[model samples]
Target: MAHRSASGSDRSPHPGRSLAGQLQHLDALRRAMARRHSLNPADMRLLWLLSDDRARTFREISEELNLEQSTVNRQVNSAARANLVQISDDQPARLVLATKEGIAAFDQDVDRSLNGYRQALERMGTEHTAEFNALLAEFIEAYRDIVQPDEEP
Candidate 1:
């Protein structure tokens, strides 16, 4: 059965064409980034999260990424093995922070990714890109409200 919106419309407010295309583009981007950086998507996400110089527990990462504890643990372990992250010896929970090398890698990856985006934006022109970004943000906010009606703005 097809899902109907609150307005009793058969059409979904969040159409698959827009959402799926965005997701597909993101996945492809991630794949290309992973190949270029020699890091898996999970590791990429972990590195990105830890790039801010803040220490985080595995639980925090798991919750923030909506990933399973075991999966987070595996990713953390892999990162540690790669010397990209350091795990503290705290009693109950081990705090994780990115190593200098990890930070460097993250910065390089970000530069490359941003350059790609900048090139695309340049092709699209500044005004149109700005308008698209604003509209995308608005769409996301509206969709979030629809999904979680009790969510605070």
Candidate 2:
């Protein structure tokens, strides 16, 4: 059955793409990028999150990344061992802060990633890129609503 949009146009719910396929493709891309940089994607994400010089607790990182506490703890410990981050004894909580090396790595990865994105955007052109971004945002919002209907704004 075709789904109808707000504009009363009939369309396939997922257009020509399947959500599972798209997710798999995205994961593959992430894995390839991580491998190219010799970094775990999760580790890279954590480093990116802490790149702004802001200190965060393990719990905060877990919540921000929607990851398990144990997973966050393990990643944090790994990063500390790599000297990518430091754990400070801040009163009752240990705050995680990105080290200078971590920030540099994050910046370098971001630059590489953005260079690819820039080339892709140039190929796609401004109008199509804008439309794709808007659609992606809409899809994200819709998925969020379905996944966490009772979540607080």
Best by TM-score: 1
lDDT of 2: 0.86
Q: CA lDDT of each candidate?
A: 0.86, 0.86
List ranges where model 2 is wrong by over 4 Å.
Answer: 1-19
Q: What lDDT tens digits, residue by residue, belong to model 1 across residues 27-61?
A: 98867866886566677799989988899999999
Kindly list the per-residue Cα lDDT of model 2 for residues 38-114, writing each as its tens digit: 45677788998897789999999999999999999999999999888999996588999999988887788878877
Error of 1 at 135 (Å): 1.6
| TM-score result, candidate 2 | 0.74
